[model samples]
Target chain A: MALVGNLRDLKLPNLIQLNCMERNSAKLTIEHAGKYGMIYFHEGQVVHAEFDPDIGEKALFRLLGLPEGKFKVENGVRAPMSTISTHWNNLLLEGLHQLDTMHASGEGKDRRLLEMFMSVKGVRRAAIITREGEIKKGDFQDDKEFALQALSFYEAEKISGLLKKEKSQFITLVTQSKRIILTEYDKDIIYLDIEAKYQLETILPFIEQVLI
Target chain B: MINRWLKEITDIAGVEGVLLVSDNGHIIEKIGTQLDQGTLEQIARRILRIITAHNLDEKSVKEIELICYNYRILAMSAKTFTIITFCGSIRALSLLRITVNVVVGHLIEDKKSMKQIGKYTGQPEIVLEKEYLDQLEIKLISKLQ
Candidate 1:
């Protein structure tokens, strides 16, 4: 749906456009009616996003879960004002359920799971990637690729560890201006790696929450 | 063997020193060059106090692998032991990761050594004035370090 009002009249779109134009690194919290979404902007690019219920990587995957090839961004020049309210909330709840499972399994502290949690929390839009040779949204079209690309190398490693019935030795998630990497090591010390380019601002808060 | 492992870890991360600490902030074994045993002990004590005051459960504290700013302090845990690494601010993430990984592996494999070290160096077992403990707890939870 066309954003119901002029870009200037919509607080979210205006803030997003302004931030995108200035290349600011900050978190934007947007609420419409009772639904809420947060978009993190880094260097004027929309790198990470979330809505009322979902906050980090889970948010991105949920967006990926949208029918393959059916995913389309209408009015790429202007943000959608239709408020994907139900979709966003559903994703948030789903993300929370996943988090609860991880926490209960004694795996909440796993860096990869934590990164996924951060990427999905409060997110509603696809990440904007500007890095060269970096995999972004197209990877989300395939579930496996999406999982590998969206998580850090450390997270992939953790998954591999679980797959092999090995104890996870270590997990690490590192984000720079251009990329997010997750790495996991098995108790026997094999490594798994994943990488993607998105804005760091959107992901930092989630990381902080997980770490702190 | 402990010295050899510490040397390997320092080589990996450019770590200045490493220490084994109890959850209560007692120092067990410390190794490396140009070490600040006193200051490091104080920092470890402060970290424990901070962890306790914040009411951070075991799960929450285990998630913090590294804390970096002006200087870098890396925390890794295995059951009852916490391994703390001190490094210069300029250390790279990869280097830090390798160092933490090697030390953590070695620590896990050498639990007996850690316990023996703990026995010899026996934590200072300080008894803080009640008011001092309260003030420190307040400062720890409220301030960012």
Candidate 2:
């Protein structure tokens, strides 16, 4: 009988490791997003693979990219052709490395975007916080204190409703020590601490540029 | 006297309402406000908490300006009270700040306002509860009756 289960229960990477370690000759089929991908293992070695329009290493990486799918492994199924020559261990490592690089680039983009804000004159500190209050980018001595600033925005949102006002866009707090600005950025909150010496109006236009 | 002082802020164009809250979250005085007593009280509590949290790090907060889509809310803290004003536009803030300074100055010297503020002095220590901080918005708004 073929081993079958959802990829969610048994991830593709783990499944590949299992088949290769067992030293079994089998063909593993994966169905994801209406597409079918197959990997051929020859006695503990990843000999061949195919995932439509891509075969061998390219197909393997593409398959690894899938977050969820259904997979079936049939024993004694042989590959009609072998296209991958790299060792299975090295292949898996490369695929995972590529995934990590892709994720890091996304985070890097957000960090660079914050750099754009920090570049503004008088912006002493800056951070992007998600709705759950996690700091997505930027740095602060106390993340807890910074996340609490979102409370002001939340209160303002409620107050706006009672006043029958439009949706909230941002909040600016001018304290004795510093001026703090909190604005919405793609569902996340951008917190900026500005020096009291600089007039808020003077730097607002430049800050708005980064927000947009 | 404090009411008259607060009136100067409400008199500004686009200024909707103003609330003078005591240091311990009491509504000492309010002028030209559309919010009911419940909503104002809730806001006062939140303001106190926000100020307290910021001050925990030893940073004294003197003012805060919240800008919504069509409204702006400004909170300014003085020796005795925190003044929260709801306005219709951002432009009103520049004018409000000048007017507020005048009001804060007068309150500091006025014996009557000082005595009234004394009643709420010695603010109780605020315990930062995670549950309270987490439910900042939806819970408070839902409680609005």
| lDDT top scorer | 2
Q: DockQ of candidates 1 onward, in order?
A: 0.02, 0.22
lDDT of 2 by residue, B1-145 (tens): 8888999888999888999887767888899887889888877877776676566555667887766656777788875578888887656556778898788888989999889878876552332444455564433222221
Docking class of 1: incorrect
Local accuracy of candidate 1 as per-residue lDDT tens digits, A45-92: 666666545545544433332211111122333332222333333544
The Cα error of candidate 1 at residue A74, in Å, is 2.9
Which is the leading candidate under TM-score? Answer: 2
lDDT of 1 at B12: 55
Candidate 1 lDDT over B1-53, as tens digits, reads 66666666666545777777776667776777354566666656644442343
Off by over 4 Å in 1: A1-202, A205-212, B33-35, B51-60, B63-70, B118-145
After TM-score superposition, the amount by which residue B39's alpha carbon in candidate 1 deviates from its true location, in angstroms, is 1.6
Kindly give the number of clashing pairs for every candidate: 32, 0
- Is model 2 an incorrect, acceptable, medium or high docking prediction? incorrect
TM score of chain A per candidate: 0.25, 0.51
Stretch of 10 with least lDDT, candidate 1 chain B: B54-63
